[model samples]
Target: MPELPEVETTRRGIEPHVTGAKVREVIVKRHDLRQPISPTLSTIEGRKILSVARRSKYLLFGIDDGSSVMIHLGMSGSLRVIAPGEAWKKHDHVGITLSNGKQLRFHDPRRFGLALHFTLPPEEHPLLKGLGPEPLEETFGVKYLRSACSTRKAAIKLVIMDAKVVVGVGNIYASESLFRAGILPQTAANTLTLPRLKRLTSAIKEVLADSIEQGGTTLRDFLKSDGEPGYFRQKLFVYERKGEPCLKCGTPIRHAVMGQRSTYWCPKCQR
Candidate 1:
């Protein structure tokens, strides 16, 4: 899935093309994606996009008329911007044609992403209502994370990845963050000491910031809006490096499944 950093990179890449541009057209090449395209999406035609905002993996394009078009790039989704009448490739689900003759195309091979439109307040959207604080935001500090982890019995990795706890900590990031903090993926959330929690919180911020800077880890389905692969994958401390030597301790990294997601860690380095 395209996590926080990838989503943010997409926001940065596409904002210049679509932001503040009038939507002369809204074309739904298909009737549905992960979910059916709500009829309300048609209302965006001719409206001007004022700004673009991201929440978790969802992107919201603010319109001049107090409305927003929300988008989610599920596993294999990508967006490309090109001139009008550009050639459409396979799985090109949506095309948002702008008055400036530019079109923003949404491509999703699995059709697991969504684009929804609404005139209701953003707070009223079902997808946005209950999401927790963004991990990159100032509100998601160590003290905040500690309290959120207080009552959880699930593994520390699972707890942090919970969207209600902090949005956008995906599997790859959870493993990387725990590895950075020297916390085992299987450690129960409530069992973490204050020191570990503190370190873990800081590591989350650092890894996420670094990933965003590097344009996110180059997971198979993720790429920058401009189609550049991220460089951060080479800097990964443990994620997807099972059997590889840990950089700090020379111990081999291990992989395990937690909540159906593959988790990587260094047994000796991460205690």
Candidate 2:
């Protein structure tokens, strides 16, 4: 799945090529993804692209006609920039051919990705309205996280992974953050002291920032817009490293299910 950093990397990668370029045409191959592709996006033809941006796992291309085109690289999707002369891959599901002869292509073998056209402010868009604060934004301070998790009975790992608590702390990041903070995955949220919470908050931000720095961890079904595989997987401390030695302690990293997601943590190092 494309997490926040992967989505952000995609936004940065394609913006340079697509921005200021006029949309010459759009080709929709198979519209049904996680949701039905809106039929009106064909109107995006001829509009100048103003900007390309990302929020959470969603990407948006601002067009001159007061409308924007949105994309979500659901579990098994990838977007890439391909030259007009380049041959399309078998999984390529959609294409936005620019006036410059370059194209933005979406590839999804599983058809879980989505392409939609909507005119409402992104904030009010049904898909975006209720999202939590961005972890990398300055507004999401430790105090903000502390407040969000106050008195919760949920496991600390699950609490932090909740989109309503904070966006972008996905399965990989949640495990890495808790491992770094020395907080057990099953620790009750309300049982954490302020000091422990502070450490956990910092760990969350650090792990997320580090992942973004490495261009995001690409386990599978994810690729940067330029098609480069993210290198963060090499730096992982606990994610998918079941039974592997913990970097900080010799004990093997443990894996368990939390919220139905595989979670990794150092049993001895954490709590």
Candidate 3:
């Protein structure tokens, strides 16, 4: 699935073309995705897009009438902007035609993406209401992470990846951040010291910011709105480097299954 950086990249790539443009039409090629395409989405026609933003892995399109459109690019999904007459490819599930003669198209071969309209304050929507603070925000600091970890007996990696603890730390990022902090993935969350927690928090922020700067890590189906694959995967430290020499210590990188997700770490470097 696309993580925060991938979603943010898509938001940035499409914002220049979509923001402030009037919607000429809203097209839904399929009503079934991870969730049903909301019928309210039809109201997007004739509305002006005010802004494009991201929350966690979801894209938010603020409209002129105070409502918003929320989209989630589930596994194997992507969004692109094409000319008005561009031929539709397979799995192009949704399209928003702009008055400027461009179309914002959504494609998800797995049919796990979502398109929904929010008439209420978007922040109050069911999907957004209880999400944790954005990991890149100043509010998600060492102190906050320490507090969140103190109450969880789960593995440190799983705790950090919990959306309720801090949003957007997916499996790939959790492994990379833990490796960067020299913390083993299976360490008990509540057992981490304050100093170690500080290191982990900083690593999380640094890794996430760097990934966003590099346009996100593309292990599989993620793509920027312009249809470019992210280059950050080339810079990975431990995730998916199983059996390869650790970049820091030359010890073979190890792999394990945690919470049903593949985890990679340096057995020697990451205690």
Candidate 4:
């Protein structure tokens, strides 16, 4: 699934083209996705897009009337801007034509993406309510992370991946962040010292910012709205380097399953 950086990249890529543009048409090629397409989506037609925003991994398209369209790019989904007359490829599930003659197209090979409508105060929506603060925000500082981890005995890797703890730190970025902070993935969350938590928090922010700058890591089906694969995978230090020499200490990188997701780390370098 696309993580925060990937989702944010898509938002930035498509925002300028879609914002302020009036919707000329709304087409649902299929009504079944991870959730059934909401019939209220038809209300988007003829509305002017006010702005594009994001919460967690969902894209929020704000319209003139205060209602918004929320979209989640599932495991194999992507959004692209194409000319109205362009031939539709397989799995192009939703299309919103803008008055500017450009169309925002959603394609999800696995049909796990979503196109739904919501009222103005989208934050209160069940899907977004209680979501942890954005990782890049000041609210997600070391003190916040430490408090969230204070009572948890779960593995630090799993603890940080919890959406209620901090939004958008997915499996790939979690491994990379832990490796950078020199904390083992299996460490108990509450056992971490304040200094270590500080490092971990900084690592999370740094890794996420770097990935977003590189257009997000493309392990499989992820792509930027412009159809480019992310280049950050080339800069990965530990996430998938199992059996390879550690970049820092030259020890073989190790791999294991934590929180049911594959984790990679340098045994010598990452405690």
Candidate 5:
């Protein structure tokens, strides 16, 4: 699935082309996404897209009529901008033709993505309501993390991965952040002190910022809106490097399954 950085990268890449451009048409090749394409989705046609923003892992396309379109690139989904009559690929499920003469295509092989139109403010939408602060926002600082982790008995990795505690700390980034903070993934969340939590928070912010700067981690299903792979994967310290020598210490990286996600860490470097 595309995480925060990946979604943010898409938002940045497409904003310049889509914002201020009127929607010429809305095409739904299929209505069965993770969330059914809203029957009212066609209402967006002829409306200008005022802005494009990302919240957590969802992209928000702000329309002139106070309505918004929210999209989620699920396990195996991507968005591409191409010519109006370009040949559609097998899984191209949705397309929005713009007055700029370009079409935005959504491709999802697993059909697990979302394309929903909501008249309400995006924060009030069921999918977005109750989501925790964005990991890179000021609202998600050390103090907020400390409070969220105060009562949890779950492993530190699991606690941070909780969308209720902080958004966009997905499996890969969580592992990378913990490794950078010198914290073990299995450490109890509530057992950590304030100073340690502070370091962990900083590491999380740093890791996410670095990934976004690099255009996000190049996972199997993620790609920039321009169809280029992100280069952050080459900079990973511990993620997916099980049994490999640690970059900091000579110890071999260790791997385990926690919260049903593969986790990697350096036994000697990460306490």
Candidate 6:
């Protein structure tokens, strides 16, 4: 699945190409995505794209007609910019042709992504209303995270992964951030001291910023809008290292299952 950084990278990659470009047409090859692509999605055909923004892992396209288009790149989805009438790939599920003679295509082999159109304020959307703060934003500092963890007895890793606690800290980032903060993934959330929570808060922001800088970690299904694979995978210290030697301590990295997701850490480095 495309995590926060991957989605942010996509937003940055496509923003310049699509911004201010009038939509010449909307084509839907498969409406049966995670959320059915609404037939009315074509209403933006004649509207100009004003801006592109990201919240959590969703891409928000601001249209001139007071409506917005939101896309979620569910497990295996990706967006690409190509020439108009470009040869379509096997999973090209949707396309938006622009006045600039470019076509924005969405591809998802697993059919788990979504493209929806709405006129309401973006934050009011049901899928977005309950989300916690963006980790990179100033609102998600140590005090905020400390409060959220104060009452939770779940494993620290699981607590941080909760979207209601903090948006965009997916399984990969949760593991990576925990490793950076020197915290065991199995530690109880409420048992963490203020200093530990402070370290954790900073670690989350740092890991995410680093990934976005590297265009996000490409672990199979993700690709930038230019179709380039993200290079962050090379910087990973844990996550998928499994039994590989820890880069910092030479201790064999440990792997386990937490919240049904693969978890990795350096046994000696992360206490």
User: Using lDDT as the measure, which candidate wins?
Assistant: 6
Per residue, candidate 5 scores C-alpha lDDT tens digits across 128-244 of: 899999988899988888888888989999999999889999999999999999999999999998988999999999999999999999999888999999888999999999899
Estimate TM-scores for all models.
0.97, 0.96, 0.98, 0.98, 0.98, 0.98
Mark the regions of model 6 whose C-alpha exceeds 4 Å error after superposition.
none
lDDT of 4 at 236: 92
Assess candidate 3 and give its TM-score to the true structure.
0.98
Deviation in Å, model 5, residue 206 alpha carbon? 0.7
Residue runs of model 3 more than 4 Å from their true location after superposition: none
Among all windows of ten consecutive residues in candidate 5, which has the lowest summed lDDT? 141-150
Candidate 5 error regions (>4 Å): none
- Relative to the true structure, candidate 2 has a C-alpha RMSD (angstroms) of 1.2
Q: Whole-model Cα lDDT per candidate?
A: 0.88, 0.86, 0.91, 0.93, 0.92, 0.93
Clash pairs of candidate 5? Answer: none
Model 1 lDDT, residue 68, Cα: 86
- Report the Cα lDDT for residue 34, model 3: 87
Q: Model 4 — which ten-residue stretch has the worst lDDT? A: 111-120
- Per-model tally of clashing residue pairs: 0, 0, 0, 0, 0, 0
The sequence of per-residue lDDT tens digits that candidate 4 reaches over residues 66-152 is: 998999998989999999888889899999999999999999999988899978599889999999999999999999998999999
Error of 6 at 25 (Å): 0.6
Report the Cα lDDT for candidate 6.
0.93
Q: What's the CA error at residue 90 for candidate 5, in Å?
A: 0.5
Tens-digit lDDT string for candidate 1 (125-234): 88888888999889998889889988999899989988999999999899989989988999999888888998998999999999999988888877688777777888
> Tens digits of per-residue lDDT for model 3 on 100-145?
9999999999998889887888778898889899999999999999
